[model samples]
Target: MTRTVTLCEVGPRDGLQMARGRMATGTKLRWIGQLAAAGLKEIEVGSFVSPRAIPQMADTGEVVRGALAIKGLTVCALACNLKGAIAAHEAGAHVLAIPISVSDTHSHANVNKGTDAQVEMVRSIVDWVRAQPRPMRIDAATATAFGCSMEGDVPLDRVVQVAAALAATGVDRIALADTVGYAHPALVRDTVRAVQDAIGDRLHKLHLHDTLGLGLANALAGLEQGIREFDSCLAGLGGCPFAPGASGNIVTEDLAFMLESMGHRTGIDLPALLAARALLRESLPDEPMRSGVAAAGIPRTFHPAALAA
Candidate 1:
């Protein structure tokens, strides 16, 4: 029997945030529908932030409403602050991902707050959600946990401290993120271990970027560390506005194939996922993409390497 891994698609929110071209709300909804049809149970639909800052996610509410119609699909939205969290909840988002930068330099640029304040932001958001009539899950991802382009290597002790504070806030789950794609396999394992030591079972997911072409390698290291949930984008679409020259997250189609080929169950149809990639390509023609399985098609006689990923 093969093990199961959960791949959360973040194309709509994280992928589109850095793109220069604007995508229509209806196109976003349709693409989301395609992703859901591809057997992606969890999808980060959009973010609820100010239009002046990121006009790309201005219509997150509408996207959330549309995604809710997809039965059995978990609609997630990225929220920066309390206002964003409330907006997401009202829009029917099932999960609220609060991206907090552990690197002070990155924090100031990305969320305009220091590390401590961001932890408090999580506390506030969690409190607000608990008060809501509907139940919502919180995924507090520590950005730049591996290293920071602005601040350089973030020490493991500091990451542990930050994750400890977040865990103390009574949040549901915590994720360590290679926000700028600066992580390697060894660092991936080490960071996962340190955060787990701090947050214990609260640490679960990894939000990775492939800026240095180490996305899949690092993700493989993460799976070796007993992590099951990973954040990825279809067609390899993503970037950090604050981290200059940083690339997208791991490619969704490629990661799916890699895991499934390793004998782990992802429940995503590769052909259907590629077809959804067509929708993403048609929607964002000018966006740059680099994919492994796309460039080199799946082999004819490939054998799975691991019994489980």
Candidate 2:
């Protein structure tokens, strides 16, 4: 039996957050439904943040509610603080992802809090969730775990420290993010190992960016280190508005293809996944979509692990 790799589609949340124009609530729901149909089990539906801050995510509550109705899909939402996490819980999100930057400068710029403060916020959020009657999984991402655009060369020890802190907070899982895409394959391997040593199985996912075109390479390194979950955007839609020079995330279609071709089970329908990209194209025509597989169609001899099994 082949190992199953979990791919969490973050296009609706991370992808749209950086889009030039806001995607309508109905359109976003439709695109998300299409992605779920394409066999993406987990999807970050939207972020629960102040509309004034990121007007694009104003409809996150509605999006999360709509996504909850999708059967067999794990609906995830991004929350920057305790208030956002409460909103996500009220909207019936199955998972709440909180990002804590490892770089102090980027942390202040992104969340107006230092790295230590964000870690405390995560602990508070976890305590609040435990008190609630309803259960919602929490995931904390150590952003800029690779390197930061504002503060270059975020030390690997700092990344492990942040991960250990988040894990100590009792969050269900932690993800390492290459927020500015400054990571190479070696960095990914070393960082994953160090964080795993501190947090063990708590570090399960990698959120990589393609700024330096090493996104896939970095992911491959993570796979070698026994990391199974990844965060990707359809049509490669995402970038940090706060982090300068940050590019879009690793393409969902390409990542799925790569994983499937490598005999790992992602349960994604490549052809169907590619077809889902149409909604983004029509909805955000001016938002340049990126994908290597989308440009050159699937190979004739291609075989997915799921289908083979």
Candidate 3:
């Protein structure tokens, strides 16, 4: 039996936020609908960050509300602070992901806060979530867990410590992210194992980048170590604000194809996913789109699906 994996699409949020041009709200909605139609169950709709900082997500609340209307789909949003979390929850986000950088320099530059400050932000967000009438799942994603572009090398011990601390905050899940595309497969395997050992099932997902073309390799390493949930962006539409050309979250279509081809069930349609990518290209003509399987095409001998059909 093929192993089942959950591919969390982060295109609407992470992918578009770093895009060169801000997509029209209706266009974003269309792309998201296309993805969901292709059988993606979960997607990060938008971020509740400051409009000045990330203008692409200026309509976060609108996007969240729109996504909520999609049946059987889980909508997630990025919340950097307690206020953002409140906005996301009110907008009807099912999951709220708060990023806490592991590298002190990156943390200071990205969130304008150090490790301790990030921890406090996570704590505040958790507390706020607890008080909300409709609770949203909180995921503490330790960004730059593998390495930092500004800081150069992040200590693994620090990553472990941050994960443990976030885990202590009563977060529903903890995630490790390679924000700058600095993680190799070996590092991914080892770090995921270590974090899982520390937090057990609390370690929920792995978010990676394709800056050096190691995205799929690192994802396979993660799968080997028992991580089922992954974060990916459509057509690789994201990049770290600090690291130029470092592609945003993993490519969703490619990742889905890789997993399904390897006898893993993603419950996603590759042809439909490719068609969605085409829609995205039409919507964002100037944006640089990416995907391994989309470019290479599915092999002639491969079966479309093998599990739960």
Candidate 4:
């Protein structure tokens, strides 16, 4: 049997949040629909953050409502605090992701709180979500888990400490994020192993970046460590506006192609996934979109793992 990997599309939320211009809510919804149609089971539609903080995601509530209309699509949203989590819940988001940066400086810059404070906030958010009538999944994404550009080398022990704290908070899952793209293959392996030892199965996903062009390599390392879920952006669009020099996320098209070619079942249609780039091109005309598979085009002999099965 072939192993299956889950790719959570984060273009609409993480990708667009860093975009220079705002994408209309309607366009975002259509792009999300296209992604879902291409067999993406989960998508981070938008962040329930203050409009003043990120104007691009101001209409997240509306986007969540629209995304709920699509059957079998798990709509996920980002929330840094309890207020944002409440708003996401009210909007009917199936999953709420709260980023807790391991670097104290980066944490303050990104979410205006220290790492310990953010952990407590996550605890509070988890409590509130459980008290609510509707059941929603909560994910605590540990940003800068590999390293931090602002604070320099973040010790591995600190990463495990934060993950353990988050696990104790009762979050359904924990995702390790290479927030500034400083991770290499070895670091990826070691970090995942360390976090797993600390939090066990709670470390379920990886959020990587391609700043130094090693995104795919690091992802391969994560795969070797038994991480099944990953966070990627369509067209390789996204960066941390708060984290200096952080750039493009792992490209969805390239990742899907790589996984399928390697006999890992991703369940994503390559042709349709490439076609969805048109929406971004047409909407964000000035934004640069990067993709290795898109540039070379799909090979004739290519076979996806789903078909191989």
Candidate 2: residue 23 lDDT (0-100): 91
Stretches of candidate 2 above 4 Å error?
none
- Candidate 1 accuracy as TM-score: 0.96
Question: Model 1, residue 18: what's the lDDT?
Answer: 91
Q: Estimate each model's TM-score.
A: 0.96, 0.99, 0.97, 0.99
Clashing pairs in 3: 238-248
Model 4 segments beyond 4 Å from truth?
none
Which ten residues in a row are the worst by lDDT in model 4? 258-267
lDDT score, candidate 2, position 264: 95
Which model, 2 or 3, shows the larger TM-score?
2
Off by over 4 Å in 1: 302-309
lDDT by residue for model 1 (204-299), tens: 999999888889999999999999999999988998888987889899988998888887888887778878877777778899876777778767
Candidate 3: tens digits of C-alpha lDDT, residues 240-291: 7765557667888888878887788888888888889877777678998887
Give candidate 4's error at residue 202 in angstroms: 1.0
Of 2 and 3, the candidate ahead on lDDT is 2
Better of 3 and 4 by lDDT: 4
Q: Give me candidate 2's TM-score against the actual structure.
A: 0.99
Select the stronger candidate by TM-score from 1 and 3.
3
lDDT of 1 at 49: 86
User: After TM-score superposition, what is the CA distance of residue 36 in candidate 3 from its true location, in Å?
Assistant: 0.5
What Cα-based lDDT does every candidate model obtain?
0.89, 0.94, 0.87, 0.94
